[model samples]
Target: MKRIMRALRRCLAVTAVLAAAFSLPATDAFASPTAPASPTPVVGGKRAAQGEFPFMVRLSMGCGGALYTQQIVLTAAHCVDGSGANTSITATGGVVDLQSSSAIKVKSTKVLQAPGYNGKGKDWALIKLAKPINQPTLKIATTTAYNSGTFTIAGWGATREGGGQQRYLNKATVPFVNDADCKKAYGDDLVPGDEICAGYLDQGGVDTCQGDSGGPMFRMDDAGAWIQVGIVSWGNGCAEPGYPGVYSEVSTFAAAIAQAASNL
Candidate 1:
């Protein structure tokens, strides 16, 4: 709940730095790879327990995702290439520690990226596993009702800016930032209704950084069920002042994601 965090996009990190240093326009980049890549870790977060987040998934290509169904994973569209047959991606779940013996691994058979994702907004995606994962699936929010307030974010991304990934899962909490304020910080880069912002805007600290891309931004519902509201998308830096972390507003694309999952 109290830590440094940022969106995990290796290329985006570099792009953000350049944009800041040179006063150039920001660009969004895909964080995942076509081949097997190292996973990233979360910084300044509390280590998660063995099964605290059963739906949490570690993508081989340096991102995170959530199990949407027995054989479907909901992630960021940028975490994968355009939706189609994809046999190179892998998903690991059921354990907080990447090296834990009880971890479950599954290969991906296909991917369904958002229909109109062009390196910008509409950054949600669905991945189909080769086989069903014997674990609980996470519930996703369908309306903007869950988009506000404090939310829980977890991942195996870097523990600090430009630091190495972690072996165990990290969990933290961040407050929601309104669109006006978010737009003031990101300008045209902040896509209203398509993206949600969360982090410490004033003091800076606590965010999901590089490697946490495609991960879920979730919170409990009134009935005590966890509902995912956003997907880690991009940010200027890891917990930098005035630049809150950006996420794909799941509510805006819930219907499309559901339809995509059914086809997958």
Candidate 2:
């Protein structure tokens, strides 16, 4: 789950430039794809059981995503280049282990990135698959109410800061950080309305890392249904104290996502 995407490095370069322009810390890194390396589980996370996350899919770019529809995947805009046809991208699902024979792989026909994404907020995007994968779809949260409490995050990304990506999916639980505290940690880099923050705060032993970008931060709703409230975006480092993981707040773009999905 490292830098598997062909354009991942280019996207990261753009991100670095944007961060510099805003005078943000160069230490801030996207929870995104990186150079290929050995595999490691998620930091402070447990290996996921098969079928535990049926909606989760591993993008060819080494990013993670959830099936938003039968043929549409909701991922981070940074995970893709832009809106256009791209048959080279693949979506692998139905198994926690990427190499499992039970896994299903589908090719993406196109990607629709969020308008005006400058490598910061507005990190969400959609990837349309060539065919529908018979699996459960993840429901995105449309209200900020679902943004609170302890949410679950899972991916094949590195288990430790600067560690390698994993072949088996892993997961962890992180508490939501209020906007005020999150803002203090990241300053102007933390987009209040456009993004959300979650982690252990002072502890920071649990969080997302590189290759986990575009993955879902979710929790069970009142009706016992999984609702995604955040999309992994960026952070200073994996599970670093005072630097909680930042994500694209789903509620802020819920309507646009639905509209985009319709057009896809």
Candidate 3:
């Protein structure tokens, strides 16, 4: 009985460590051996139903994205930095469950990483689909609406830290943290203009974890339409107190996003 108890304790310890390192892709560029993990989807959230978030997309490269237009997808820059015309990237949408057959898959024709994206802020990318999808696209947040409020984030990332990717989409609501408080949390790691912070300071057990990178952090507009305010970028650990998840601030680069989308 003593040996069995010891084995159980070790398993619990491993689970805790895995939960702490929550980034989705687990790449060297975004995470170091000493740095807290970054990326992925909701931790402590409920599963989403089909068509709940119509714009949510699952990337073949282990990230989440949002459909900006019929032919364009907005995702994290790190997910497409080295990917080009030859890369076989696919974006699956229109389904909540990854295993469902109702998904709409589109191949990428080109990938455009934001200018000067190097695993830091401005961690956004635009993927041009080979064919346009017929679903509705999410509107970008152009004002300071994202500066403060309760935001909803969704993705197909791991349900827990250090776990395998989830088959069903998960959704969570988190409060936005001010830049001042966020700065205190991330210190020199925080990018003010390029990133927005969202999560609970009290460690309320609500946050995006691994496999959710590049997913949408959004809120409803005054008209009740969904507007994307941020893109899942990085964080210290999943749902850790004082360390809210950082996202690419959509308002900061709305013009750039428009230009890139228009050109394509």
**Candidate 1 lDDT, 1-264, residue by residue in tens:** 011122335222354442332242212122222322333335445767888899999887767899999899998877776878999888999998676689889999999889978767898889899998898999999998888889999987765566445557889889999999999998887789999999889987788886788999999998999999999998887878898889999989989888988888
Question: In model 2, which runs have C-alpha deviations exceeding 4 angstroms?
Answer: 1-40
lDDT of 3 by residue, 1-264 (tens): 332221121111233433443333444212232432333336778768778898899887678899999889998876665545734788889888665678788899998899887656787889999998788899998877656789999987765555556667879899989899999977767789898999999755778876788899999898999999999877765777877888889999999999989986
Q: For model 2, give the 10-residue run with minimal summed lDDT.
A: 3-12
What does the lDDT come to for candidate 1?
0.78
* Two-way TM-score contest, 1 vs 3, winner: 1
Candidate 3: give the clashing pairs.
23-38, 24-211, 40-209, 40-210, 40-211, 40-212, 40-213, 41-209, 41-212
User: What does the lDDT read for residue 262 in candidate 1?
Assistant: 89
Query: What C-alpha root-mean-square deviation, in Å, does candidate 3 show against the real structure?
Result: 10.1
What TM-score does model 2 achieve against the real structure?
0.85
* Between candidates 2 and 3, the TM-score winner: 2
In each prediction, how many residue pairs overlap at the backbone (N, C-alpha, C within less than 3 A)? 17, 5, 9
Candidates in order: C-alpha RMSD to true structure: 8.7, 8.0, 10.1
